[model samples]
Target: MKAFVFPGQGSQFVGMGKDLYETSPLAKELFDKADAILGFKITEIMFAGTDEQLKETKVTQPAVFLHSVISALCMGEAFEPSMVAGHSLGEFSALVASGALSFEDGLRLVAARANAMQKACEANPGTMAAIIGLSDEHVEEICKEVSVGGKVVIPANYNCPGQLVISGDVEAVDAACEKLKEAGAKRALPLKVGGAFHSPLMQPAQEELQEAIEKTGFNTPKCPVYQNVDAKPHTDPTEIKQNLIAQLTSSVRWTASVQHMIADGADDFTECGPGKALQGMIGRIDRNVALHGIA
Candidate 1:
């Protein structure tokens, strides 16, 4: 079976969709539609804007979504997947690609999500860190230990074996990194992110995004979508929506999601996005699977 995956934020670049916009009519039309939908020329920022401008949460989220979804859609008949999954913000892209959500609705939801998250960041300041060469259990234990009193810290992304990202208040995350390094982690490095995502700090964002998710219409996708919240495949719109609601405050089980996909017979994994981040993570998760990318 084939599994098509989408990447999240941090995969974007200054000239992300330039080639697509210049080469494919469908892509050009979608880019124009996105510009109108967003009420700003996102294509300009995506194609030639400065990195600082592209780094804005609002722009980065939608930019990555457009690139990923358009990359998959432009493939036409060749884009087929028995199952699909995406990382963090890429979930919206996956939904649009798999036919669960209309392109316009998906873009709207992504924009709303990005805005909400940005607000939550300003309201509750926090950060994230990458813990390398540590077991999931170790990272979780260390985070729990650091999250004392009213402080909050937790494992945010189970990207692959021996690599996990933790998110929480800046002080708590810094303390956790100190302990994780002492626990034999090869490296405990802070990420250059605007806020702590996939942690309790995002609860505010979750509430704000829930309203948008609830109001949006979701159709039954042609294939099952393995969600980030639980690493489980879901086809029901109601179930998918609920999972999406919780995704902001839940860890992205990328390692487990890939494992489940392979266990369910997905041997061919094709990534449709701007970068090969998902492919690299999947490769580290399981080296036996055939991995490739569309972008």
Candidate 2:
């Protein structure tokens, strides 16, 4: 069986989806529709915008979604997946690809999520850091015990073996990094993200997104989508909504998600996005696994 994956933020770059739009009429049509739906020329930004412009959360989320989804679109009959999973923002892309959400609705939700997260970041002013060569339990324990000024830090993304990302207030994150390094972690590096995503700092964003998600409708997907919150597959709409709502404050279980897919007979994996980050992570997680990239 084939499993298709989508990448999250930090995988985007300048001229991401330009090639497909310029070469395929189908891709062009989709790009035009995205522009109309987004109320701006997002394609221009994605195709020609500088790195600085694409780094904006609002632009970054939607641009990466468009690239992954459109790349899947251009694949036509060749795009087949027994299971699908995405990292963070890429979950929206996987939902659309699997038919759980319509293209326009998915894009709208992604935009709303990005804007809400950006606002929450501005309001909280927190950050995230990458901790390597530390057990997840040790890292989490350190973050929980190393609070400063009553601020909280927590493990955020489990990217791969020996790699975990922590998110929280800037001071708490910095303090936690020092502790992690002292705890024998190989490296404790701060990420360039604007805020402490997947942490309590995003509570406001989660609350705002709840309304948007509740108002939107979801359909049964063509295939099962391994969600980010739990890294499990669910077909029920209500359950999907609940998981999505909880995802904002939950660590992205990418490593576990890939393991589940492998155990469930994911013989081949394909990453559809701007970068090969997913492929690399999946490779590290299971070297025997076959992997491919879609644009």
Candidate 3:
């Protein structure tokens, strides 16, 4: 029972895939193909660009995806998964690794998703915040209360116990942070993200990406993928496509997904991505489960 997990967004760094590029010719070929597909030298930015440059939404998403998918590919026969799951943008990586989507199509969709999300952010200025030391119920209730009179705020990521991220309008999120802190939260910290992803504010991005997703072809996956939107295992291409499209404006149920995986016999989790963030979260979710990281 091994589950291969992929990380998203914040997992990226300046020199993320340089070691893979330098060590494996297969990795180099994929990196070169990525540059051509993206119409730019993304590998250069990933290996030597400034942190500020890597932080750009368009660069961050695809860079992380490339690292994750390429790492899994380089594993060759060793990269077997009973189940797969990803956090946010990493879902695209999971699909590619599991054979649900081709490498080229996954990269294209990820680039499209990033550009669409960036456009949505510019069109509607919003933000996200981390709420620590609060129960999920309390956070959800407070978010609902704060989301009134056109203010749209909601829980976005259920990372682990006592840790959740909320996203929405800037003012609403700030206000929610204050209220959450006042309600005995250990820390209510704002995240340095481009916009309120996984919230109603991303509806425009969802609409824009839906077309790209529907147009892309999907195949039956080699293994089940635990989708972000529903925290459920999906093998059907049609269902996976629908869930991926909904993920743009839906919460990432990481906690539930991990729990479900564990209950369904996922005794080990290998994080194949730029950072060990998913490993840490999976550790928090269940200490008994074995955890490993490829990057």
Q: Of the candidates shown, which would achieve the greatest lDDT relative to the real structure? A: 3
User: Of the candidates numbered 1 and 3, which has the greater lDDT value?
Assistant: 3
Of 2 and 3, which scores higher on TM-score?
3
lDDT of 2 by residue, 1-295 (tens): 9999999999998989898998999999999999999999998899888889999998999999999999997899988889999999989999999999999999999999999999999999999999989888899899879875679998999989999999998889989999888899999999989999999999999999999999999998888999988889988889999999999989999999999999999979999989999999999899999999987
Cα lDDT, all candidates? 0.95, 0.92, 0.96
Q: Which stretches of candidate 3 lie above 4 Å from their native place? A: none
TM values, all candidates: 0.99, 0.98, 0.99
Candidate 3 lDDT over residue span 39-92, tens digit each: 999999999999999999989999999999999999999998999999999999
Candidate 3 lDDT (Cα, 0 to 1)? 0.96
Residue pairs in collision within model 2:
none
The Cα error of candidate 2 at residue 6, in Å, is 0.3
Candidate 2 lDDT score at position 215: 99
